[model samples]
Target: MLKSMRENVKSLKWVLWLVVAAFVVSIFFIWGASGKLTGDDAGNTLAVIGRKKISGDDYLQALRNRIEAIKSQYQEIDRAFIEQLNLPQQVLEQLVEQTLLVEQARAMRLRASDEELRDRITSIPGLQQNGKFVGYEMYKRVLQYNHINLSEFEHSLRQDIVLDKMIRLLTAGLAVTPDEVWSDYQKASDSAGIDLLILETSKVSLDEAPSAAEVQAFFEARKGAYLIPEKREGLAVFLKAEDLKKEIELSEKDIENYYQANLSRFTNPESVRVGRIWLPFEGKDKALVEAEGRRVLERLGAGGDFAALARELSKDAKASGGGDYGFYDWQSLPQPERDEIHRLTSGQTSDLIAEADGLAVIRVTEKTAATTTPLAGASAQIRSILLDEKARQLADTRIAKIEKEAKSARSLETALRKAGLKGESTGLLKNGEAWSDNDPSGAVGTALFGLKEKEVSAPVYTYTGVGLVELRKVEAPRPAAFEEVKADVETALVNERKMETSRARLAALGRRLEEKNWEDIAARNGFEFKTVEAHKRDQYIAIVGESKTADDLAFTLPLNEASAPFDFETGTAVLRVRDRKTVTREEFENVKETQTAQILNQKKNMFLQAYLAKLKQEKGIQIKYDKFLQLTQDVLSRYESAKQ
Candidate 1:
């Protein structure tokens, strides 16, 4: 189970991507504590960080919140799948980091006052009605309806305020020096061309055959890799939500009640949806910026694609979305831009509008009038929503009953019989194997592999609905005999030899690279000799694909100097710097200010991450292993006492 859990957590590459993507977004999701840990809470603590104690209950809530967030990205995610992904631990790590950041803020004497917290909460778009806070009672009701505890949410929000303050305090003064700007400019503008000697690993052949002893030795060295994965056989009872939905019958009263109770959801304000192409005039000449904006507007007038042009030239972050600014409330927008959008009809383009920062051309895509959805018009949608809600409620009630019975009886089949549900037999399935398409969330696989023989699992939710599993048998992986895997061993040996031979040949070629002509050496050795045209730092190489090592060598290696053998996926290769280009001082000066600010922001982010990593290392996180194990089992429904 641990091995499977580890497999599902994202790799380091994904973590790095998240570091950039969530740098700002992360502040919102970090649920924090009140900094008042009592002895009672400490008894149930999952982890300790200095004076901070993360209780089991807090951890559970954090895990639940994290699961809901994950569900937004993966609609089919359920309890079993969450367990498989080791999300409980992931959430714990996040909480620990939040604690650390909060602690640092307090140490720095940063405080989020009650007024600030109140302002922040009232300012939230969800908690507002017509741009006004929906009073105290309505606020509590809204939070309750969403299953958010008011106190916990407030505390978490307060911590977020503190963290934001600290981040601003730390990064506000950071700026790139003149030398740093020049260095970044060089990296962006410089290009390099390389002469290559390539040896394809697949084409390499081994004339000599390995002895029996060598093959045996290779197999022995990698015995664990050769073992078959563990498998499990189980019985399960699944209830599809769609099937339950078919049985639900919504009355007219139900639709009316839902409409009345959730009137805010049915209200629509007057709004305009516009696509904008903004040209900023911060660093560039204002005349040039306006000229470029006019050219783009002229292209639009001549039937050019708005979205395509936006993607190609717009400077806004939403440029990737084809410059879509989305719908904005009629009153929220400012100035002549709003007036310009209001004047244009749907699908009509606006004339170039001047703003404080830049020139923008707006295209009005849609205009909506203020209105409330009447019950007669919303009946079909309300009925569907009520049907889904009631179906889920019924499903949860039934699953809870089944879980109760299974726990008391210790037999999933008997519990199914009591519930008048048929038990389906799952044939032996290896770890990580999906039983069927119905289990797209991998809930069945997660339940089956985590259970012991004759042990019944808690209610496992799947893409379709919910289910319970009973493990009947477990097949532990075992080592294969030498003769049984002889052919596999020989294949492995041959591949290893191919790599070794390619590396050896490349090493030999590297020695003569400076003495002989590159093409002559390549021709004599039957390797390909080619020159990759000059490309920027981020561009992909022709034969080598995209590689940081290759990029570094290309930019750093002196002209006519040969590089050491660099091993890429397809083969090994040596490169000689053939040509280079450097940007002129005039060109660098053109974008110096913009490049400096961009590089400074990137550097600050890197420094922040490195600082946090070092802080975490120095103040080591201590876990209460027994409590953590209990928490994991409790969350996954592994313990008999875990179910509601």
Candidate 2:
């Protein structure tokens, strides 16, 4: 019975299956080995959770899998973005959380049966076709495509199922009460009308500038802020692959070899230019919606203009634009939709297709048959590829030879001169600054800063090519003279004075609330009065800026009452609530189920977070951040090398 049910259930979509594969493979890479320390003198442990130590090989492989996953999403992934996300620390933290949960699951004696694991694998949509499992060979092919081992994938799947079962046990019976549901409904449905007055700092003027003594004092107090940054002077010899492309020559054999190796790249998939007319149900009876869809299709079949009919009767957002969905590859659409579309010839319309939310009619305006480029037709592209390959090889050889000579010579400049290459001087650069205007990659600067005076660096790869750098000089930061920054100090003091004046005026306006009309006060104080109508908590109030402080105050203040001055980026706002509305009982009842589900989910998430935190605290989970970072650097080095 379980196998039959699993076979009937739809498998996970391909994209989701790939994500699961990546995550599962990463876990195996972290803990798949014999659970023993190996190789490293400092021990191969990357982290320890409870009684288990996560090995370096596991962590490195996990990191590599993560990089590959990221690369799939982003075409131009870089080190800076990776560092910004602090991915290594994030991955380690996730592993630690998983370990805590798995340990707790084991303590509770929770386990997943082999049948359950098999059922789960068979249920994935990516491994199924035509409502049936695609057999073991196909399943293995899917795993191979995702770079996952069959045994390891099954092991991770078993662990995931166990963890899920444990989580379900922990969160079972969680519910939302009537009061909680009512409170959530009110918050979601409430809206406020507000009157606002804004004060702009730019409009406020100061009477006097700061004296020389005051300016000097300000500079003295913040002298470190004005210090000159340290600078470096260096010479770099660069070799670019593209520059060497003109020197290298490609033959017919090379072109044919490239073409034969990458035939898939030269093949074009079949595509259809498609247009759609969507009729949304919009709470209508399903039978009525289907009838309306059929009526539209009949009209289209009987010489009705698709665009005109769509503009007149279609409820889709793109109705006015003729409901044109444009060109699409066959594989890009859902299987059902693709099957329907494929049966139609160009300029033919399909019947009313019942979809999840509504009904759709598809029209194929044009079709392009799939074709593969012949060797003669693909010669130009292949030649370009071979040329690039040859250029890179030659450039790499040249850079290696240059690096060897630079290492043996007294100076990089001497080596470059001997090799008939001219080295460019960067003149001066700050520690964190680029070595040259053209060196935006910062590889040269990074290499130069790490070197001592007169020291040369190994070849560093940049966007342009490879670079060899020599450190010529280093100048440490020093405090600047007061006179040099006197103007800057004056400007700062003036802005501070203006801000004080603006605040005083705003406060005085706040104090006169009861006696004066807000509109009259705005006229008297040179502030503009604006009204915001029926805005919810999350909605942006244009008059009061995008800040939520005004929104919160509007809801909290009594109707027909003014709020204290709220400060935002543009300036300060004084707000008054004009009206407020709460959700009606009938309205709340209509969405009670949805609200309950949302609240229950929120409670579950909170409980899970707190559970993880408590488990970490109880287990005394200790992380060596330095070790994680070093491991990350080593993994990134390997990733970069693999890419090259």
The candidate that wins on lDDT is 1
Residue-level lDDT of model 1, residues 1-644, one tens digit each, is 33422331212222222331342124334563332222356467777887777788777666655654564354244456776788877877777777788789989999889999988777765444455765666556545543446776677667778878998888988877898888778878898878888887788988988999999999999887887667788998877777899888877888899889867656655656788887889888989998898899889999999999989988876789998877632222335667787788889998778765677788888877768868897777677667755676687789889888988998888888998888988778776577776677666877787788889976676546677789998878788878878999998898788877877897886568886478888888988787878777867777678878888888889988888888877778888888888888889888988898799889888877887888788888776543454455444531111111
Q: Residue by residue across 314-403, what tens digits does model 2's lDDT show?
A: 776667878765552223333455678788889888888766457778788887777887999888766755665566557667777877
Which parts of model 1 are misplaced by more than 4 Å?
1-158, 161-224, 250-388, 425-432, 448-453, 481-567, 570-576, 579-644
lDDT of 1: 0.73
Q: How accurate locally, in lDDT, is each candidate?
A: 0.73, 0.71
Candidate 2 structure, TM-score to reference: 0.54
For model 1, name the residue pairs that clash: none
| Residue 35 in candidate 2, Cα distance off native in Å | 20
Clashes of each: 0, 6
The lowest-lDDT stretch of 10 consecutive residues in candidate 2 is: 635-644
After best superposition, candidate 2 residue 160: deviation in angstroms? 6.7
> Candidate 2: where is the Cα deviation over 4 Å?
1-116, 119-217, 224-233, 240-268, 273-299, 304-340, 350-362, 369-395, 409-411, 422-428, 452-455, 472-478, 483-644
TM-scores, in order shown? 0.48, 0.54
